[model samples]
Target chain A: MAQYELYRRSSLGMALTDTLDELITESHIDPQIAMKVLAQFDLTIAEALHNRVKAKAAIKGHLHVYRFCDDVWTFIVDRPTFKLEGSETVHADRIKVVACTARAPPGGKPE
Target chain B: MSNQLVPSVYTYVIDEVCEKVAPTFAEMGVGQNVLAELRQTWKRKIASMRVADFDFKESFDDGYGVYDGAGGQYGTEYYGGDHNDSSFAAAANLAALASGVGGDGTAPDSYHIPQNDGAGDEAQAETSKVVETAQPSQREIDELVQRLWQERHRAEGEAAEEQGRGSLAKQRIRQLDGVDDDDDEEDEDDNEDGIGSDLDDEDSEDETADVSHIILCQYEKVNRVKNKWKCTLKDGIITVNGRDYVFNKAQGDFEW
Candidate 1:
């Protein structure tokens, strides 16, 4: 699967970046190495999610804004509740969804 | 339960990335210890986020998670186990600490007496505790001030450009400046909501301001009719409430 740069915005991604930043700042690793690590992270996280996670979530929200641009869909929802399996729920004041097209465009990068 | 999967998924990602990058590190002549250190540091940072009980190592459990739990427990004991009393004390201590460090030295003598109690080891422990709590608040205040300064600079930059535009555009810029100021005020109010609430407040602010609560996944189909929308998203990493969840499939229903 082609890696999307989108997952880099998650907390897991941010934590990785912060750690890499500290390493770079302290001369523990080169910037180039850090970039390679991040690229690897992008691929690994996508595959791990697809292969390892079996959970499903149901989201209900008031859609405030929706945009389809460049084969990606962006949804801004206000006061969203994510109901996962087993009655677990997560509530947020607002959530933004960025979904890449599942079906790869012909001759384009597959998501 | 989905949120519960975060730690393991993250751990898997971290381990896999480390493994994949090992050859590169060796090729670059970087020491393997640094790779191991990177893993440790990454895990430590994630643990500090307190999204869940990581429980990966005894050291992390003792170092960060237990420190947080102990802080709360200490407050409860000090305030006779009353939640409201403990929170009020925590707020007062935060205010006193903030003013003591950020402003003039007039933050009431009562708050300073403990620091000057001269109880030897007891005094040292109390001072360290104060420092431990003070550091995060100081960092947050610094960040908020930096953001406000940046916003001011941006508004000035826009004003300079507005002089070349029509008066209508200038009015629009002014309105935008008003909106920015309102948002700043709201941020300040969030900061003042109390020390205990600060973490959650900052998280939500990050979510809204930086679009942190986002899902990056592949959509199989997204259909809409009237004001209703439905979508089937798969292989997504969803971040909400400062925790990450991975879902193989997600069904979204929303009304505009």
Candidate 2:
């Protein structure tokens, strides 16, 4: 009985703008739309992150997903050296992260 | 090509240009030492920009010999004939079309026939050159930096969260093992009650819930694989290998 919905893929910035546009255009926006937008944002951000990590040959960070309004949201950041298995090398001084989420409609599934 | 040093810092080879040919133009007004320094600086900047990743070779070599230093992988670039009078019409058209440019020469407009006039061709050529020249533009650098920063941040958060989850799981496991403290027992009851109320609200739409549906979305980020969940429910708990996972009342969606 499980159903699935797919959203278009785009950059994090574009996804944010799209979500805002949808909200403004449709007075009664559905959670499914928000979920799709946020999922897309997360995927784009993750791909960019993965590419960077591969290019630099360094362990970049981790992504966190949490439940929000019947959907899931992801936040990404760099892993600290101390927190890693091998703390003897590659110490990170500071890091940054991006937060995004996917929401489902009142009676729909979140993706 | 070996003898005509273009004296350019860029490690790329222009179509027929070689690095050996220090342009007579570069020598006339500029002192030889100054020109050499400029070339060195250009090389350093290119290095900083990491153009090597794009396969830009150091010099160019044609049968007659190199002129501008064009040995690297040829990339789309704008070549200008007259600086001020140059038009990227052709290049722009090509680029526009390539970039999915539409009708009104603007995004969101209907597609139109691309300009095919001389001016249009020149313009398009210019666009091609400029696009190559601007490869590692400031905007690109900023984007790279921003992405890297985000990965770093996400990794940190995940580590912390996983640690927290592990601890919580351990605490719960211990309590379930029947060696729980009074406090632990109380928490179990509280959780059950709370979750039960949530379930009651959820069951109102049980007719639409189904356990067969599950969507797992995973992606690589910051050199790590991350998993995201998507799920909808009907009236039953999704038992995966004898374990139940919480899901909402909607259908699941995901992509590989």
Candidate 3:
């Protein structure tokens, strides 16, 4: 199961991701909690490059996912290239390969 | 939003998105360069104009979303005022009561809730923002890590905290749940084997484990000094430096 967080975003589609040196994505599902809650959902992560089937165009290094809906995009990825500042990597942030996951309610199953 | 061009990093927009390529860029994780490739600075000036008419409700699944007495998919966030007043735990508890996922938030006959916490399908799903990210480590890897880490701790004589070594919630997840059939039996076996740390009532604290929140319980570290080398006895086979050594736990020593 993916973790959930209250994220502040711009209407144009950007989280105040680096506000006060915090990545908004980190606030989503906790990496450990994700294991049990997200076991059922089918998931995939394709690199943006060399894959034409992921989206309408090309994106480099972006993860390719086959979600039932378009709404579930903002993933809880471990700060890949977006290097963190001091004390950021001190705790859980040091963990590698954190997966993003979220389970939807019954009513909103994608069409 | 476009004209703002507030320099920093970690920003995303759909207008700049090229479906196929964008998803790949998204995989690398967000950065200024990724955004540079995705969004042209020349067109960024229109961001403010583009967002002028942007509506929160427009992002919702439908005009008004419905809850199945379980989780509610309200679409992208619609945060207003100070949302910090409500915690995920509180929201989960409230949602459980409202949706009746588990009538009293108790462990029902099914393995609905991962741990004994009142959190079940509804609390675990609805309030949770179901973002579609890549799969992290596989279950096999998780188990192996758990096993190897435990073995390493034991070999190092750092097994005092036997109950709280790894993610206990993970060990409880039922691969094929629904009825309390074979999983229950396996759960019991796990409890006895000492592998399933949470099965024991003594390790209940592990249930309260919340790796989700930023305000975590930073346990005091015990920097102890000891010999780095150890004699490991595994499946009666102990590989040393490069040679196989015969380990005798009773004798508390090893022979080459």
Using DockQ, give the best candidate's number.
Answer: 1
Model 1 steric clash pairs: none
- lDDT of each residue in B1-256, candidate 2, tens digit only: 0001111211222111112223432433333443233233233333333312223234311311322343221111212323212233333344344334223333311111122233453445355544454434445435534543454455555555566685497775666577657757786777665644554444433322222122222212112223533332221111121121211222322211
lDDT of 3 by residue, B1-256 (tens): 1111212111222232333334443554444443332233212322322423223224322323332112231112323212322333343344344334333333222221222243453455432322221112244334533544444444334323344357763444443354468768777777774664543442332233212311110011112124211111111111111111111110111111
- Which residues of candidate 3, in runs, are more than 4 Å off? A1-111, B1-9, B12-15, B18-77, B80-187, B190-256
Model 1, span B80-122: residue lDDT tens: 4354333444544555454444343434323323533335535
Instruction: Give the per-residue lDDT of model 3 (tens digit) for A48-87.
Output: 1111111111001222111112322221112112111222
Better of 1 and 2 by lDDT: 1
Q: For every model shown, what is its TM-score relative to the native structure?
A: 0.62, 0.17, 0.18
Which order, best to worst by lDDT?
1, 2, 3
Off by over 4 Å in 2: A1-79, A82-89, A97-111, B1-256
Poorly placed runs, candidate 1 (over 4 Å): A105-111, B57-212
The best-first sequence of candidates by TM-score reads 1, 3, 2
lDDT against the true structure, per candidate, is 0.73, 0.30, 0.25
Which of the two, 1 or 2, has more DockQ? 1
